[model samples]
Target: MDLIRQARARLAARLVVVTGASSGIGRAFVEAMAPSGARFVLVARRRELLEQLADHVRDSGSHAMVQALDLRDVEAGRAAAEEVLAHHGIPEVLFSNAGHSIARGLRGLVARPDSVTRSVAANFTGPVCHALPLLGAMCTRGGGHFIATTTVDARTSVPGWSPNVASKAGWDAWARSVAPELRSDGVATSLLAFPLVATPMLPPARRARARCAMSPEAAAEWVARAVVTRQARVAPWWLRPHELLHAAAPVLTARVTAPFSMRLVDRG
Candidate 1:
């Protein structure tokens, strides 16, 4: 057990790129892996927070490279990927965890096309924009690990989360379809179906329902464990039952979840 633990830590402590590194799960992942002496490329829009995390990573005796940019911009995401490749070389791991959510009903989302656009760009287009170049480089090198943070909403398509659900569903589908193809190129892909984690992304009411939600730190540790164990899917054990239920009866599952998800709607 100790050997396995040590090995996991060592494996996690390698050159890696993590998007959305400023806070929540991204920050926790950095903190959790720092002790293993992991070198990190922290990508996020917040310069100050990225610097703070870089300092924290450096303090832990690891190298930290900061790329402060919004992943929603395809040009910028590509530039950041290029810069990282130029300086740090291709990372052994790419954690495409950056995302955005809209707690608005479909009517509300339709009322403001701009919000829907941004949400889609952030949750779906952004990761792919940043990842394609990086993944190509990894394939050239003969191996790499790609971890994408997804959600149960993708499967259930809960109300008041149209943008979030659709965007993640697209991302999730892309990862699943490509995982097998990527494997032939020696690249491994993981689509992590996260049940609500207590992160800044969630509204106050949602965060209060703590039974099903994992702490960001716990989620981060789980991600690291997946990387170490080479697991293609990283999710809480409790989520399995929910997944099975959805698989067996998606419409019924959606009906059951609708009322609770409606609470997330921005009625105003």
Candidate 2:
């Protein structure tokens, strides 16, 4: 079978949980997998959007349960996890894709520190807290997949996007550190280091400049590939080379990129 067929076969009739399912790549992913007959637990802060998406899933002959809550509320997130376990049982696949991005210089952040707090909560603490219970449940079940949507920015520090980059980097590191333990218990983890995708998450200025950004549907295909292959990490071909350059000469790379980074911040 082709990879798409393989992914469909594996996912058919399986219970899948997707965070940030209201729009963008998350919504696109659910739509792509709906035809495969996978049941989904859709999560996002928007109730009406998720309800609309759930209706579409139903139309595609798939089951969808909508959970509308902000992931940043740790208590609420834990409660939602408990509810998912009780109602849907343990999901065979958990796509922890909810994220927040803040593009601010240090000067701006010093004035509005709440942006940093929001970034850390949404990008790192929120997802981790929400997934903790489900992860344990999956471990007991003996077979499950955990997929996280990260960014290429997580691999390197960008001057204008410190909070967003740092938080995502923390998540990436945490997932990598826990992968071995999850594998020992028959649970697999995949971290997708996505490039700029034309999603609502992008700032207006960035979105305008991202003429080459991948569409949400295209990004969803990458997720499906990860589902089928259970790869530990999925990233662009140029990512490693970029990382190497930064690692080899961090100061020089930073100096060379400083002008561009300043421009990005200035635009926002």
Candidate 3:
């Protein structure tokens, strides 16, 4: 299949649930893909923003439904699934885009337990709590897609980013573990393990790396396409080389990456 055809074949006219749908990358996805004629479950604690997004979709002549959900809550996932299934189908696609990014180093992690809690909640367990219930239905339907955004951290580490790295590591593993199962059942799953982008999640140093930063809009477009195309997972075509370098030698890669940050956690 051609790239666009490959990317969106699975997602067309499907129900998509996007958590953290208020702004940043999540909003970018909705705005980018609205033309595709999909039903939406827009999840975020910010009702105002979600309503704004839904209004935008309606203005564009596409349909969107908003749900105010705090992803940190255990029930948010199930409630979202049920909401989508009620109006639409069992969400032919799920985007677990809610996440937390802390600009603290290891020492700061000790000082701030709450950051870890939020990070873990949004990055790891949130997706699990939400996606598991939908899996059986998707498999039975013989088609669906699950996608979550993981940062560059899971591939390597930098100063002041341990929690993000660790949280996304858990999230990444959760996606990978289910990927094969989903694939076998004609359901597709992927982790869009993105490189540093212009999303709100970026720290200043990471933002500086934005000399090459993908626009949230561009990133959103790629993700939307991937759903139907079923590439399974995606990163920049260029990231594979860097990912290979990290895979071969993490310590060296970490050392190299540490210098990229202005703040290094000097304490153990």
Candidate 4:
């Protein structure tokens, strides 16, 4: 049972929207959240996969609507959210969990600007597209939860993959800015950042990064609890102090971690 289920009747009272619902963390999210007994809007690019996840969630006796769309397009966010509203009303929790990582850096992909741009839009701008309307609605409604699954890259900039770091950093800054505002209205806002996860988003050559990676199911369940319970922020508890230090002296940690990360990434 979910820790958020303590007030089952109250919590089950509204829909929840989770982006990146096709595979990895997204699919795991559908599975993790199914038992919460809330109507769900699952959005992703894989139509069949989303439908399959929907069937599985419904088998658990929960309601779900699967919409296949590309968040990179951004307009798709509005269309998908609008559909959810038309059928299920506003959601209680909005989860932005879709993202991918590339091990190679900009210098490595000099010829593929389009590819780099897509990654940036998907990892960063997608959250803004999905959340702006939801934020407005949730604020007006007086209570709701919003979660953005950022990357540890949001903190440490990678030389090779400037797009990923830059984009996710934008996401982190936006989330931080919005958190205080949302709290004033009783809406919980949180940003969950992960190191390399063992989810399918893990690139093969960089498999070493998932050495101590979190499982998709675990990430999903953890994030589900985060948005639902209104936990202010979450990361590995031990990292809290490090995060504080990172805030106080990002360049120091960046200089320290970069060489180590570079060597590891270079090895693969």
Q: Rate the local accuracy (lDDT) of all candidates.
A: 0.82, 0.89, 0.75, 0.73
Colliding residue pairs in candidate 4: 105-160, 105-161, 106-160
- Clash pairs, model 1 backbone: none
Per-residue lDDT over 61-92 for candidate 1, one digit per residue giving the tens place of the 0 to 100 score: 78899999988999999999998889889888
Worst 10 residues of 1 by lDDT: 1-10
lDDT of each residue in 1-268, candidate 4, tens digit only:
4543542344464677888888887787678667657788888888998999999888987888887888887888777776676678777888888876654544556666665677678877876887788777888889888877887667654565566677788888888998999888877887787765786665655555557888886787567667556676667765666667788987787778766555423111
Q: 1 or 3, which is superior by lDDT?
A: 1
Model 3 has an lDDT value of 0.75
Ten contiguous residues with the weakest lDDT in model 4: 259-268
Query: How well does candidate 3 match the true structure in TM-score terms?
Result: 0.88
Where does model 1 exceed 4 Å of error?
1-8, 238-241
Error of 2 at 162 (Å): 0.2
Rank all candidate structures by their lDDT, best first, as comma-separated numbers: 2, 1, 3, 4
Candidate 3 has which clashing residue pairs, if any?
6-229, 7-225, 7-229, 8-228, 8-229, 9-228, 10-228
lDDT of 3 by residue, 129-242 (tens): 877777778888888788878776676656577767788898888788888888889888877877766976665655675687888877787776677566767777766787
